[model samples]
Target: MIEPTMELGGPTGPKHRPGTLQNVVFAVRGQAAELAFRDAVQG
Candidate 1:
């Protein structure tokens, strides 16, 4: 996910541009972080 998103160079080509793909990346990472945190806490 991060690989492809980073490969696009982002939505604006060069400049900083927000897009749904970026959102998906953020959500995926966020969910992963949350799950890891929960596992750590429970363990």
Candidate 2:
């Protein structure tokens, strides 16, 4: 039930682009997995 938000690169250089959909998806999934692992460890 985790709702991830997309982060667009601002005027602070061009470290992050806005057209990489696959990267966004992978990032979210990695974050979700990390969170889940932490929760399981705590529980």
Candidate 3:
């Protein structure tokens, strides 16, 4: 399962490429969780 990556050119293997649909969802979920954690700690 080769996939494009930002670390280097070409599809090296399984990876989360920036701007891809999967990455977008993962980034959103991660950021949401991070913000929730921050609020829990600071607020």
In candidate 3, stretches whose alpha carbon ends up further than 4 angstroms from where it belongs are 1-19
Candidate number achieving the greatest lDDT relative to the actual structure? 1
Give, for candidate 3, the lowest lDDT window spanning 10 residues: 5-14
Comparing 1 and 2 on lDDT, the stronger one: 1
* Candidate 2 structure, TM-score to reference: 0.57
Q: Candidates' TM-scores?
A: 0.54, 0.57, 0.53
lDDT of 2 at 20: 73
Q: For residues 1-43, could you state the per-residue lDDT of candidate 1 as single tens digits?
A: 2544343443443344455576666656766776787799999
Task: Give lDDT per model, in order.
Answer: 0.58, 0.56, 0.52
TM-score: the better of candidates 2 and 3: 2
Q: Which stretches of candidate 1 lie over 4 Å from their true place?
A: 1-19
Of the two candidates 2 and 3, the one with more favorable lDDT, higher being better, is: 2
Number of colliding residue pairs in model 1: 0
Clash count, candidate 3: 0
Which of the two, 1 or 3, has more lDDT? 1
